[model samples]
Target: MNLHSTPPRSGAVLAALAGAQFTVMLATSIVNVALPQIRVGVGLSDGGTTWVVNAYGLAFGALLLAGGRAADLLGRRRVLMAGLGLFAVASLTAGLAGSSDVLIAARAAQGVGAAAIAPAALALAMGLFPSGAGRGRALGVWGAVSGAGGAGGVLLGGVLTQAWGWPWIFHSVAFGTVLVLAAVAALIPRASSAEGGKFDLLGTVTITVSLTCLVWGLTTARGSGWTDPGVLGALLGSTVLLGAFVVIERRRSDALVPPRLFRTGRVAAGNLLMALLGSVWIALFFFLPLYQQQVLGMGPLATGAGQLPLAAANMLGASLAPRVSRRIGDSATVIAALLTTAAGMLWLARISADGSYVGHVLGPSILIGLGLSTAFVQLTALAVGGVPPQDAGLAGGLVNTTRQVGGAIGLAALATLAGTVTTHAAVTRTPQLEAVTAGYRAAFTVSAAVLTAAALLALLLTRRSGWQRTVATAPARRSAEPRASAVS
Candidate 1:
């Protein structure tokens, strides 16, 4: 289909695309609250349980570029449907898993599916809305959907795990996948495949291997010391592999990630900011539930309930972000969001064994949620800001890949740091509760610092001159065309 020439069915297309995006993102964090139950049910060790999360993230992060390029070469609708089917099947397999190995494998399979779905869905959404206010609004809704999915995953996982079993989380995802599949079939227009590009097999393989090795090394650092030969070897191998992949991409005629994309300052800055933001956000989800359950003696249901405010605030912030950006500009919005998030993380660093949920958790959650939601919308726009239409899927994949890879690395590093702190404090005869709280606090402090650094980088690296030029020209560009139909 000629996306620009077609009569806009914006509502149906946006709904279908956003639904697919939500389904894929939901799986990203759906198991956070159920990690404890899954560990017991599958007889997993602490290290093995971590893989339950990392395996999916690693595969998803590694394969996203390949998937995005494939969608460009193949038809987006065709690739999207195939991905949804694969996701549903993988969800079923995960739900039925009786061993950690099986569950991890299934989760990795789900990641492969998610890698395809995310970029295609994002590209399709971009295609549905023309540039200017319409595109900005659509992206805001897209960001809101993504935030809701991430936050809701925790709530839903807790509810399902409490009422049924850990397996129910996967089952619920499977059901949602089926519904989204039907929506895609009905609402998404079929497009002719773009032909003539050679797949970058060498680049794909090397990059995938490099990321896999990096995640494996990070994950192993917790069990074996960071200085362990195996961990050091894997990390070194990953660095070499990544260097090789970059070389291959430079040489390839049809590179998976076109090197020119990195030349744009906004694209580069946005991606770096996303990487830092994702690291802290994922670490928060991983550690906060443990704090509530282990330190505050909260049940799964209560923990889930406590997260509702965060989810709601995230949605509200996302909806308002685009409007805010119109007045303040995207860079200013991003900087403001990062500073707000950093402040929230700093507040959370004060958590004590005796801290109350309302006093400590609720306030920080609101700040972090609002910050994440607002930043996510603007960052996504910034990442893809000036890219050609043909490269939308590639841009989407790059942003998503950075987020997943950052999450995987961050979770592993923070988890290891927390474990080390807790272990040392215990060895020194500190009370267990106090020791764990100290570890959480230390992690939160680091997270705050990371956000502060990201804010500074945004200030330094974001191309203000180029962005201002685009904003200055947007009104003239939009005025020449007829008004596009509103999605809602």
Candidate 2:
């Protein structure tokens, strides 16, 4: 808890770190409910409007690895402050942007800042609380903030847009960024970077472009036909770039993501699980709001407000995760959390157009919420648990990159599937509302299936090679293993 043997302000340091995470996440999702006003103000076409969201996502997702590595080579604390400064500037620019393109560019700039901020912030937090109950509690707080940020964004988006205007959304984020910057500068201590090595510029460029292409292709595929020439070209280009990146990294002594990082099964497995969780997580956020507004005929504000239950439950579950992990081993905790969330998704799949929010949404939200945070907390620990200190920032970046990429890809696939289902239903002369509801049901059903599969994989992956070693506080692990014993 002390951050060091002599830190006098542990709470302040943690708060500063959490604020950084929350602000970046808030900036990401805060644009959702304000899109209508944003579109009108910027004179955006429907396609252009979607790009507002996609631009931020693209830049943020694609450059995350580079950002993470920057932290490693340049120092976590240094990169964090730099990122926050950029974020504040970008947010202010976005608030004052006069044209659609300018706004989009500003958002992309903000994404770049967020990419740097998120990984550095997490790495700093993990470094602060090295082990034991303190580490577990810190992760719990981190996960809870991560889970709540999106929901809070939606709620605030509506509130600000209605009470003030769309520009206020960006302004508010800018204000938050400044405040977090001050807190972090004052509270957090300086940390060392990787001792020596040139940054992997080649690997960075190739992987960044590869990810950008991949995410763009997926986003485009969801809107335009997958067979569209541009989409196909983007996908093909991404694959080629990715292959080249792999070959390049293997040759480089100073790789952006070293091949040896995956030597330990824990890092590999943790990332895979995070990807799976991210897929379901994206689908839930994307579909749930639309379900409330489109199917239930609620307004934007109402839809935003509806998410409160889920947000609250998610934070509570995050708070509870460490305690549960204390009782059950880390792997078991992940398995249980996945299964619990899967059950919630299945319950949600039973939704009807005629159903009320209480029956169709509220119950499932609570159940899913309980599972998501726990899984996220455990997966973070598993991914970075034993990574060498020099590679901690890179490890953080890699884990986050997988989650973002997985979410983008998964949302595209699920959305495509749902669109197909709705079209087919309409062809059969189904009611509009019913068809939409059925499509949502299909997405949730498939999500539940995916989560169940992930749970089984987590069990299998950990059983053969113990995962307890990766956890922060592996009290549930016995026989006085070194990693298990070191924490307590």
Candidate 3:
């Protein structure tokens, strides 16, 4: 699973990896549509219902770096298998849970498994294909499936909740996990450990706790204000822990994340772009649904059905991204994609209370879906472009971590912004629907501006060669992968 080798079984390998990722993304979104049924089924309080989602996200985001590092150190195949087993067990437990506590705990366990699975899957995919066009095409397929997974979850959740029950959603994921686990075992070749020695312990613990505090603080800030004592305490605690992590990394030869990785301009710039794009991308999903349901009065099924066009366009754009990247280079293609996404956001900002779905939502959704997927694909590829074999897992984990963190920050801030706008509009004697629509529009406008800033920054970095212009192909660069180790 390295350069100059394409096994005949590559398709099966890709499917296994992609399916695992699909499950991870699907698990994140599906619960939203079924939340009501889930609440009644488990007798959850409002806070408990919210924690059902937050539990998964907090664990997923917090442990991702450690998961990726584990993949490298423990061996990708072993880690993926173990993760799938844990995911399957958790999914079943969640499906069978009769109490709120059990369900939330199981969801957190699922996230723990997902943190391991996501990085391991991506790292293995990278290993299957060589650098340049081969890897780009594989990544395109990865992007396509990932986008479809998220959209599909919304649709599937509604259907599952209506026809079967909320538990079926979790059950479905369990079934899929079992299928992919079998495929992975049969198809993927076993990988060797990155090195004989163990990974850094203190650094891992510090960073994991730091990230947990950061995500928890952000999650809490959505409901509680930023100035709330708990939120402030958690944020301050995270900052302190992060500082300790940096000091430990700098001093340790076997750092949890090698200090030199950040010095690579490609990794640095690419992840920065990822954070920016992910913020806007996540907010789009959140606000769009609220606009559809609350403003336009669409039911859950209709809302999910309406997103079919968006999902199709996303897959189409992802499929086309690799070819576009090859022709224009990664930086140029990413810049163009970002601009396209910004334009879509601006178009969506024109949403109105009285507007029809076909008239208002459809066109902007197609544009956003196409441009967002393309941008995500190219930027994701760019993030891992110059990394050596040993760093692949870390790179995979880093990109996913940034996306999750960005998504959390974006959703919380945008929700707060929307609420503030709605409150102001209501105070001014605007009608309820109109005021809410105004808030949605404001969110979209700000999202467009953020995307524009991302595009501008990418353009500036490309011109300055802060992003390695030839990193996409990587033929000229030496494979400077340092030896890494397994944690005991």
RMSD in order of candidates: 2.8, 3.3, 2.8
**Residue-wise lDDT of candidate 1 within 1-488, one digit each (tens)?**
34444556667778888988998888988998898899999999988888888788878888888888777667577878899999999999999999989999999999999999998888777666646777778788888889889888888998999999999999999999999999888776565445337777888889888988887888788778899999999999999999998888888778988877766567777788898898988888888888998999998888888888888888888888888888887778889999999999999999998898998899999999899988888888877766655577778888998888787788878888898899999999999999999999989999999999999888876655354422211464643332222110
Report how far off residue 278 is in candidate 2 (Å).
0.5
* Per-residue accuracy of model 3 over 1-488 as CA lDDT, tens digit each: 43224456677778788999999988988787788789999999988998888999999999999998888877887888899999999999999999999999999999999999999898888776646566677788888888888788788887888889999999999999999999988877555435334688899999999999998998888778889999999999999999999899999888888866766677777788999988887777677777888899987788778778888999999989988877878788888898898999999999998999999999998998898889888888777766756777788899999988888888778888998999999999999999999999999999999999999999887766566454445563332332122110
Which portions of model 3 show Cα errors greater than 4 Å? 1-6, 192-194, 465-472, 476-488
For all candidates, what are the clash counts? 1, 0, 3
Worst 10 residues of 3 by lDDT: 479-488
Strongest candidate by lDDT: 2
Judged by whole-model lDDT over C-alpha atoms, candidate 1 comes out at 0.83
TM-score of each: 0.94, 0.95, 0.94
Weakest ten-residue segment in model 2 by summed lDDT: 479-488
Which residue segments of model 2 deviate by more than 4 Å? 1-5, 191-194, 474-488
Clashes of 3: 3
Tens-digit per-residue lDDT, 1-488, candidate 2: 12454456766878888999998878867888788899999899988888888888889999999998988788787889999999999999999999999999999999999999998888887776666777789899988998889778888887888889999999999999999999988876554323456899999999999999999999889889799999999999999999999899989999999977777789999999899999989778888878887899877678778889988988999998888888877888999999999999999999998988987899999999989988999999888876766677888899989989999988999999999999999999999999999999999999999999999999898976567655578454322323211111
TM-score, candidate 1, is: 0.94
List clashing residue pairs in candidate 1.
Answer: 1-191
